[model samples]
Target: MISKLRFNTVVGKKVLMAVTGLAMVVFLIGHLIGNLQLLWSGAQFNGYAHFLTAQPVVILIELGLLAIFLLHIVDAVVLLQGNYAARPVPYHTKKWGRSKSKRSKKTWASTMMMWTGIAILLFVPFHVWHFKYHNPVASARPDSGQVSPVVVGVGSTGVNTSGAASAPSKEAYDLALQVTKEFKNPFVSGIYILAMILLGLHMYHAISSALTSVGANHPRYQTLIIWGGRIFTVVIAGGFLLIPALILSGLIDPAKTLATAQAANNQVAQVPMGVGK
Candidate 1:
């Protein structure tokens, strides 16, 4: 029926909002899996980052994601405004609980979805800048096949190591190094952790409402939907939360390790051509 749903109708807008939210949830899970590559090794993680960053498909996907996010936020704001305008002036806040048990109305997480959504929305840009666009150590050319099996440094910067390896491959920066440095700082890690907590809260309420908005709710399976919301929120939010926590705890010391990599590169550069042979 959505094929016939009109944008002017509340159900249509809600449906759009729900679909967008779920899309982002899938994106987050996929992203988390990719990010976990950092635990494997710098090359493994950086290569993955490089692969995604240089791809046209990834860029298009990112643009699509941006559109979805904007739609979701705008739709939500409009819906909230409509609900507000429809409520009787005196009953706007005081009587909203009349249809529900007092405890339901008092539930903070459900009521604070708007605030939590806003918080997560604001946090995303900071995250992008800190770990994506501004990455000091991610090789951008690996995905494009600019380099072969291994990229050697071009002078002081390059993603490969040929005759002279230098500066962690200038083209491809080491994301492991960048993120490790960022997360090691308490201010950065603290904000990250706090945002993840808020994200969990937002998802807890958002997912449940999203399920209902898309007509996935039926008395027979309502309990499953509720528990699914909780599982999704906890796994996604908790997974991301663990990353910064590990970095802050010094478990993911990519900065130091990167330096060691550079040191190794330098050492190899100085070796006599036939000495090892």
Candidate 2:
């Protein structure tokens, strides 16, 4: 009987949502760590990007992530619909309801979960297209050596060991420079900051709720679990927010960084292919 209820019941759906949501939260932490590399040199960040793309399993990983993300979204929608059906009558007042016996766990974050999740859904594709598909280097300042020479066989795999300033070329698209340039735009920066805020709100409730759904309930550890989730929420959201904030404030200069990347690429271009090998 226990096995029969695993996937067919509302409890089963909540458990599935909890597991998938937690998986994504873990992915977010790893992604934040990788993005923090932007605080370093463009060459370093681009090298990291190059390494990721060069991996044979990258596509598989992406497909798997996509599957998990879609499943999470679908289940969330289903659960939300189920909730509406269960509560056909709307509440008269927007105030919180509580009794002497039990306190309500509802907060602003929990209340807005669906909306915030939808916003994040809209954000991910645009982000992927902006960084992954668009060639910002093509629109870069060519006169300032922001453009690097493209190698026919080799992509941006060339590491500029020279300490000179240069830009990433179409072949290797200086991703770090691209990031700085995009963030410098007021609209882009604003959108990213807003998105991170929504992510924080979503995560605040999600972590605690997910744990409860997964049967992690225990009076002894409840407070610790809730606080731990909040800390995780702040770190993930705050770390992402810092990037655009720094770029827009002129702390991470795009022009100088691009020139350095370009100079490195230019030097690498002049060297004979087999010389380094």
Candidate 3:
């Protein structure tokens, strides 16, 4: 029986789906926590973002995440194709609930899992483009004849006035600030918040279902899985929501915050020269 199942193509696809889905669930939790830093303040969020790209270990993790994302997408396409192939004939159904109640009784959230997955896939590239690729606000150019400012403690990846490295640019920072400023626009902010809510809904089902698909469905620990899903959903979604709320409230203004810090640094630089004279 075991060998027969192993040889089955459907079984192989199921295993692939389970593994990739679970990996993505873990990534989502980590990403949500990292994004939560935006709620504390602009400096805090920017520093956190900077730290992620600057660290070697984090860079490796990001590569792993990219791999997982690709694997999940590939598996999803394969599984979807297999599912369609298995049901090539269209059945005419007069009534929706005429079939087995066992299937109908399954949670609606779980049934809609594929739709949620599609939504997430659609959202990700837009998110990456907005925050990472072509980031306009974070780039900085050095003053004439001065080397670019070395992002202190940024090590080898740090930006310098010379602009030798594509280190986080002042342009990226300004872009980030401008993006946040848009949150003040009711329509834009509303859409962002709604997208986050959909993300939460997607995670809520995906987390526990992925576990169950991976042989964690035994009755002995099912309750724990359910509670874990709820908690994970709340924490991740709740934390992310705080960022938009704070931005809309004007509690975090990236441009103003950066300008203030730069002014203070300039004042400190001049103070020592005046004292010596």
Candidate 4:
């Protein structure tokens, strides 16, 4: 009977989903923390971005992240197909019995996570293309107005240096500023806000599910996982959503942030090599 069950055939797929999901969650936490630097001031946010993107370690992390993202998508598609194949017969009746029916009911986060996952999967490549692949200056161009390119340079400690060119067109600093500014459009901003909400909902379910998948669930630890999931969801989602809102409200200045980052880069460039010689 055990041999007939063919359990091993599907174990690899299950393991893939669990491991990839866990990696994604860890990445989300780090991403959210970096974003929260926006609250400190424009300089703080830009510096944080600069620091993150400048590191060799971060570059390696990003490559690993890309791999995990692809793995998750591949696993999801495979599992979905397998599930469809396993349930080839359609249910003939609506009644699944009271107990089973009740069990089917799920929280909004739990119910919508699959859809949210799909949305995020769609959104990510577009996001990377817009920011990471495009020219930062072109990407940051005001949709309907003309403003002189403002170049803000960093001093010894986050101060602007003189004679620096306008911020580069393809840097992360420029891309982030552009994103905040672009959301001034109500339609665009609304969609971004909704996407963030969906992300939050996805995290709410994914976090707890990951814990269970990893065999971490227990009577004593179950409640802890649930509460932790909710908090993680809210913090990450809320923080990201706040960025566009703040930009729309004119509370955050992307241009200024970009300027600071550029200046910081310049300062580092200006450091004379072999000064002791």
Candidate 5:
């Protein structure tokens, strides 16, 4: 049975699509958790970022995720094309089925899946460009060859110049601060919130659909599964929406939360060669 499965086959494509889509959902949950660290402190978020980037396997994981994303896109296009070819005549007046015996599982989210998916696809590149490649904070820092504080050691304490013990200063990339600055911009925050809404729509149907495709469609538990998907959609989407909303509302003040930068020369001079290790 496994040997007979191929990309040309419909079942094969659905299975691949289901697997890839589920993989992305897992990634989204993990990503949201990491991003939420921004609410705590810049030191905490930067520490989390440093831990991930410091791993040698991080590059490999990124490459794997890219492959999964591309595969999901290609499979979706093939399925869509096949669907159109199978039904050459578009429906003239589609209506939701209301009969109890034969109720339609269709939803607004399901109907607009392609549109939401496209919007998310466009947003992904812009997000990556804005946060990953562009760093206003780093760019503004002096050109001196000083190692930026990446991650602070957990529970570690260091003495200030006055020889008084203090919480180790986390003066690295300051991504948490940068995230605040970006979200405070009306244009950037607006785009982010809109993209999150579309993402919620896409996931609303996708979660149940992916589960069903993978054979989790037993009649006795189908309803339960669908409702669970709905709840998951709200939590993930709402969690993301709260970040920018809080920033814009002046609730998460970066000035009081982030670690202050020490003098440039002192920072560069104090950083050990084994930093971020």
Candidate 6:
């Protein structure tokens, strides 16, 4: 069954794509919720980021998400190649050409899926590196628009179940500081907005397509599925867009509740490298 579900057969490949696409949609919804927290407070957003990175469970979840993304993209490329091979040339050249061009103009969302996917693929690695892997050094002086961070260690200050002091815990990175720096960049913000719009376009068509491919085709529910696709695109993409928009617009202040560069560095200076986790 597993072997049959690989990429050899067209039906199997479509099913796989539908499954993976839906998985990504779930991730997008969760990510959007996390990011929307940025609108409330820097500490909240930073704390959320710290929560994701400081726990092993979150790391495992991240790994699983990465695998899902890889599978989706790889499978999509294979399917695309198979489609091109199966129809090397239009059987009815003039007739097919006119209709294809008309369809392209009419359904821009569907037509641009492959191109938008490629654009998003190119942007994600840099985004993850900038926001996740790299951190601003605490010693450097950040301008009003720029920011950096240092990880802070948790102390034995928590009240235990028996009303005793709990043991000291691990350190957590200052993610808000890092995010503020990245989002404050006009160039980066611009590109991110563009990529997200592209992502929305990709999702708009993808949602309905996945539903159809997966055989969610009851006439009574078809309209709902189609509308659901649109709603998902707007909600997920618009939710994700809010963070950068707030930062760029100066609504989310990096220095308001988030850690300052000097403060971050000072907190982590005594702790050894990699001890924050």
Best by lDDT: 2
Per-candidate TM vs. native? 0.78, 0.80, 0.70, 0.71, 0.79, 0.75
**In candidate 1, which residue ranges exceed 4 Å CA deviation?**
1-5, 92-106, 136-168, 255-259, 264-277
Per-residue lDDT tens digits of candidate 3, residues 42-106? 45555666655445576577688788888878877887888789888888865446265644424
lDDT for each residue of candidate 6 in 15-62, tens digit (9 for 90 to 100): 888998899888888888887776776567655654554344765787
Candidate 4 — which residues are off by over 4 angstroms?
Answer: 1-9, 95-105, 135-176, 251-277
Q: RMSD, model 2, all Cα superposed? A: 7.6
Summarize candidate 5's per-residue lDDT along 1-277 as a digit string, tens digits.
Answer: 9686566698778989989999999999999998888788756775676566555575687789889989999998999999889988889986567444355678899999999999999998888778765542232112223443332222122312111222235333445656877899878889999999999999999999999988888889899879999999999988998888888788986534644443332353245433422
Give each model's whole-structure lDDT.
Answer: 0.70, 0.72, 0.59, 0.63, 0.71, 0.66
Superposed Cα deviation of residue 187, candidate 3 (Å): 4.0
lDDT of 4 by residue, 6-122 (tens): 434466566667789888878877887877776555556655655554344765787899999998888778778888899899788755354566534257777676799999998
Model 5 segments more than 4 A misplaced: 1-7, 98-102, 136-171, 260-277
- Candidate 3's displacement at residue 217, Å, is 1.5
lDDT for model 5: 0.71
How well does model 4 score by local distance difference test?
0.63
Instruction: For residue 123, give model 6's deviation from the true position in Å.
Output: 1.5
Ten-residue stretch with the least lDDT total in model 2: 146-155
Per-model root-mean-square deviation over C-alphas: 6.9, 7.6, 7.7, 8.9, 6.7, 7.5
- lDDT per residue for candidate 1 within 153-242, as digits (tens), equals 321234442223333433333456557667888999999999999999988887878899899998898778878898988999999898
